[model samples]
Target: MTSTAIAIAAGGGGDVVAASVLAQRLRHRFDVVAIMSYSWDRLIVDPTPGPRGLGDFDGLTSHHELVAQVTVSTVLRGPGRSTLPPLAHYVGCPLLLMDPVGGVAGLAAQFGAASRVFGAQTLLVVDVGGDILAEGTEAGLRSPLADSMSLAAAVRSGLGLHLLVAGLGLDGELTPPELTSLLQRHGATEVAELGAADVTRFAEVWNWHPSEASGLLCVAADGWRGRVETQRDALIDITDDATIVYEVDAYGVAANSLAANLIATTSLADAEQRVRTRRGYSDIDIERDRVPALARHDEWTPAADTVGAIDRYAYAAANRGVNALTIRRVLELAGASGAGAATRLRELLKCERPHNMRPPLYLA
Candidate 1:
């Protein structure tokens, strides 16, 4: 039997970075295949052309071949511009949409069947944060924990058949107790602080971090403005407002997944209030100051808004489409389930207004 392996790098630059790092490592042992939900177009590029943009995964490693298969639509618009159509039609193999909401599952399953022609597995990864244990009224839809559990259940039983939880970082330094509690609540069997080296070791596993080079793509809103020159130096291709939104959005989504409520702000004051009231911490810390900047700058934005960014970045990768059979191999190992598990999982995956979301941010 071919020792096939799959690695899913979810979220912003960090996910990509983790993917890259892991890809290099896996190349040594197994046929390292990757499923990039967003930002592959921007990450993998020919940097020799010159200075372009940040998060450019150019010339990072020569060992592994990076394959692009699926693409997720930006969350900024409705069905017309959303990624659902193209992703549903083009993916063609055991399809795994990172977060497969209600209408998207049937299509995902269809693709899965097509992929099975060549032998593959389909999987999905969802970030629920800390909103799971609430009432299922409209208000609960926004609950992070509930949302994650719901999505996990849906994929577990649905066409996707495999699910993984992404973005579970705690705001401040997580005490051991807090980490244990967080893990127990999420039903995760293992957790690790991701770094460059870990990527290679877990490259063959269904659940592993992306490459560190991928993390280069992440830019905080505040850092983008201040570090524009630095970013320009790092990336191989730089254009007018090259899509930096994906990193911001991914980071925001990941942050929201851990917090109790939806962290949002139209202005700096709103951000401060959200942090103060929800997180219950003084805004005097260095990291706290960084949060506002990350939100305000171009690279960082609220997770809900960052959907557009991820779409723009994935445009090219989606066009290429990787080997569907390889994706199926990865999904089989993920071991995710579907909707029959609970009512809470179904409710969380539905789209709803952000304000109605729950848990309130807990400031560090």
Candidate 2:
């Protein structure tokens, strides 16, 4: 079967949520084969330095294999547990993780191998935010290495990959005006907007992962295009374009920025070194060598203490909008699952906006 892999730019998780919306928007035209992502999810999972390359996994496999890859134990780390690949199995999307070990060339090779295995005709590296198009010098641009590296690998993959930037500026990395202007300069053409079904699917993911960015985009997609206030940061006037999924030729975006040069010219470490040299801080460098986000290490404590973990984690999930995957891990860490856990989760969780108090869609 002909496949089209949809890879979330940075580490997976919420990005997969965005890609799920994008895949539905594509209407199953392709197999949507492997849902590719990096292992470096710093938001919920502990931040590792570089991406947990393919080495961190048991190579490529089918959807069922994907589920087996990220067991509940794998997702739930105790107090000190840090990095874990996206609980992609929860969304029922098979995942492919690009290791940062080989730099651009290595990632390209990995992409090729996975594509060949899945018979992917086209590869699309998706970024939830439009930061994939950033030129690295943009003041607001923080994590350019992953996006730029994906862009570089797509170009080098020789597969003529497509680039999709959804919910532009919703990440607060770059404003909508800035992204639109960047695309215009890069000569990007308007591709397509998420359809009604697409919006419905997007809403499902948004409900579970009530992040500030995707929430704003979902609100916009549902026809609210005003400046939405969050606890922190400036009010962002999300435009109609927030729901629009824009694509550009990988080469064009690379040609427009010197950031692309770093990925193309140097190894992953070298490229990160250069960005750190210029930016004074590189998330890749710091996170690559960093510990697990949860800091629980691998072992799980007894079920007795799990109730406590559930209480604390539920509050964080409800109040902070930590996303569904993290909540699932919390449940797992607490030695909880199924209806009983769901009951505890509902009772413990606070805040009801977006109905995050309910069990996650994965659990439901």
Candidate 3:
């Protein structure tokens, strides 16, 4: 079988970490290529003398070794023009742009053969923030959500696709049922929830590097293990601020696990409680509120608007036997497929007019 050429579009350190883990797991089946759209240099640089910059890239060493040789590129130019790197410049084979929120599909289409080779299988992972959605327009491409939904619908019409939502933060009130319903509405056929244990397993399989092996020992000795055990139960009931903290701390521990003295030992419950308490402080909350929005949906209405665009396109495509895919098809392939939320969103707007007040179909 021909090797799948996969492209990962990562923005932050966390994104890079996730992509690296995925690359390691699929190395045998794929020729993985990573396209980083943000600058790690700026994120890490700090004027202060003590431990400056954000931190080293997590899993950098392992990524260099186990995964297909990784490549890093910045999407933005300086602090202004937020456009991503032209996707036309990177096309060579079947491609999948991870989190191509900022108009990457349009750019990819410009590559002609690359876009056709990937076809409806071209996928993008959508997050709550919608950064991928925003980048679509910024890069002069159609909305990523629209393209994703179209692809999903097409896949559903033909092959049996499945969806699996893994590594969802356990700190929020979002339930498996809720997620399943949402995915189903968008055209998914399955939906599964993953927990901390699953995450740990993924990390191990990826052979992540340890920054401070000794710090992990210190954390274990400092009762971190007991704390973590106690917090496991709390993780299930997480709905408020406490749970959020627990989730963040858990993520931090997971990220810093490479440090010998910094092993994450705190129970999910205690970590949650600590995070809640910390957030309670006026200064902390105030500072956190200042953090810039990472996803485009937080500010732009394009993603939401594109939901209708996708529905219209799907309906038209179905009528014409175009074999278009929708979000549901993509999720089905991922394993945690369902479309309850997407269906409801469409229904709710059934009677509403399109934002531009333009007819659903356009003719040249």
- Who wins the lDDT comparison? 2
lDDT of 1 by residue, 1-364 (tens): 3233333333322343333443343345333333334321111111121111112322221221222133333221211122222332322221222322221232233234333432434332322122222222222122122232223223322332323332222111232354345445444432222332443332322112112222222221112211111111121221122112111122223333422232222222333344345445322233434433333232221344332432332343334431111111111112111112111221331233223211110000
Cα lDDT of candidate 1 equals: 0.27
Using TM-score as the yardstick, the better of models 1 and 2 is: 2
> Residue-wise lDDT of candidate 2 within 58-115, one digit each (tens)?
4334333222234323443322121233345444566555566667777777777766
Clashes of 1: 55
Which runs in model 3 stand beyond 4 Å of their true positions? 9-13, 35-164, 169-173, 183-364
User: Of 1 and 3, which scores higher on lDDT?
Assistant: 1
- Lowest lDDT sum, 10 consecutive residues, model 3, at 241-250
TM-score per candidate, in order? 0.30, 0.69, 0.29
